[model samples]
Target: MEVKRVRALAQRALIRRWAEDLGSPSAGLATVEAIRSHLSRWVERRHGTFSFRLTQVLTGHGCLGRYLHRIARREMTSSCHECGAPSDTALHTLIEFSAWGPQRHSLAAFVGGDLSLPSVINAMIDSERCWKEMVLFCENVMTQKEAAERERENSTADPLRRRGPGRRRLRYGHLLLPP
Candidate 1:
């Protein structure tokens, strides 16, 4: 079925479910109806027909009903590991992470620095410039993680690597003798 039709049907079903849960007018059916109408209007105002599914996936909501609840709560936050900054909000994390200054500089160098989050998101969704940069960023992070893991492994396996080869012996890369 078309997505809009599906969404409308889902909304209708949700309103019905809410109404059923209320059981009778004594249970405040009018309030439930008002809420449903408000939500439908909100969906229309925000162009939810085009983005409801994507927003659900990105925001960790698996269904339209859950996504609507999450949006209503405005629940978004993550703590920045680098600076202990609260990077919970979408805009803050995307545009204002303390560690993001350098990362954004790097990204801008590769993709144009002045780009905004919405533009970047659009680019990523459209498989444009920001998409390429996102891939590069992931690669760089993976490479750094791999390097750190190798260093950790090497350090644990051979402490002499932390010291000079003079303390041990030249294995493959360099030639150094103990002084």
Candidate 2:
């Protein structure tokens, strides 16, 4: 019941309509207020490494994706080159990447064994999981991502690869025509 109310309150406008939802600060507030309310009510604000990293996952802002594309137009492809997956969203990386199966499974079990993104977020502070474990998970995900980026950079930087046609592949995958 409370979970349903929390989800509903997170919707901004519906927050007020759910008059019985007066317990949560987001029950009848603006969108920004609702966000701030949730942060103020549920999340800790002080300096904590795990919470800082977790917030990036919660807000859908960390790692490679559309946001990374925006930040580094040339460095990142909108789609994942390694997996040939479309969008390559943060959610996809966290919940769908095949290579992350083991980490995901362990993290999912730690959270609630559901493996759903929403469940994972809701379980952020659940008694079943510890914050340090979540932090380690986030750290591992980031380490893997960083290593992939470095590998890609090293591959693209090598200049000795021979091309079949009269074209060349640059660091950003752009083709160079023969002189």
Candidate 3:
């Protein structure tokens, strides 16, 4: 087979594998599911500069309390620290958290009504202004959340309760070396 054709076949297979993974109920990729709804192909490119805060809001993989609780038990509860919601997931933080009411209202205006992840994403894709508005909202909320997290860590008197900035994971009872 030609090299170009071979590469195309490989790419298709990879995309198919990713789609299967994303669809699996066991995969637990709720945020990725939101992005998948907007994609034309399994691996379409989005136009825009990437920002950490925006990615966190879209992916639910960052400093969000639910994610933090799940990943490393860094948080005592998955509830929103600001509003005490059941889960501090990305959707909750962006759309439901009362603390971000002002910013959410601003973003909703650009999104054209009540905000859903898909609506936020659609608005972002349709207009650069909307994209900026969403990013700004994510930054504003995430920054405050992060600052509060840091303050909590610093104020705690227990040394064991304080978290280190570096990440460490145990692998078979041994610490994995940081890359």
Candidate 4:
């Protein structure tokens, strides 16, 4: 049993080391670096959990659309549903999407528009208003993107509809009437 435990621990350590080594060399990997910077300071919090759970999204890459899609295998492409940009990355959602321009401006003003991950994290730690604005901006973008995806799905003719129109979809835990 002791030998088995030692073997398991050794394998885990090896896998971790290999993963870290392969973590880099991708094109346009600044977003990953920025996320790392935020996480590096996670333990030494300059402020308490300000905006609450939303801050977790800001600190990790896995919360981004690309990672989520990749994990779920929902679609072949990880492109932004709004703009069709490649791999709706965290940086792209936060910095590049023109759809959120107005909200970005508001959040940017609070955080001084640095747009760096550490800066945003620091701003959240430093001010509750900044934390709130950041959370609102991120949440707004996600909500808009999800709404757009729903619109796309609804617009596309369901193959079953060709069989005839007695189709219903569940919305808000209730059945939606057919058009």
What's the TM-score of each model vs. the native? 0.30, 0.56, 0.75, 0.57
Better of 1 and 2 by lDDT: 2
Quantify all predictions' global Cα lDDT against the true fold.
0.44, 0.56, 0.76, 0.63
lDDT of 3 by residue, 52-144 (tens): 998887778776888878875787778877777878898888877787889988888988985887777777777778889989998998899
By TM-score, highest first, what's the ranking? Answer: 3, 4, 2, 1
Highest lDDT scorer: 3
Clashes of each: 3, 0, 0, 0
Could you give me the TM-score of model 2 versus the true structure? 0.56
Measured by TM-score, how close is model 3 to the native structure? 0.75
CA deviation > 4 Å runs, candidate 3: 1-21, 25-28, 41-46, 165-179
* lDDT tens readout by residue for model 4, 41-143: 4434555453432543454333355754665344456777667888787778778888778988998999997977768867876677887788887677666
Which order, best to worst by lDDT? 3, 4, 2, 1
**Pick by TM-score: 1 or 4, better one:** 4
lDDT of 1 by residue, 31-143 (tens): 33433434433333422122432332233332122222344332233333334554433334335555446655676665555545444444454444555565554344334
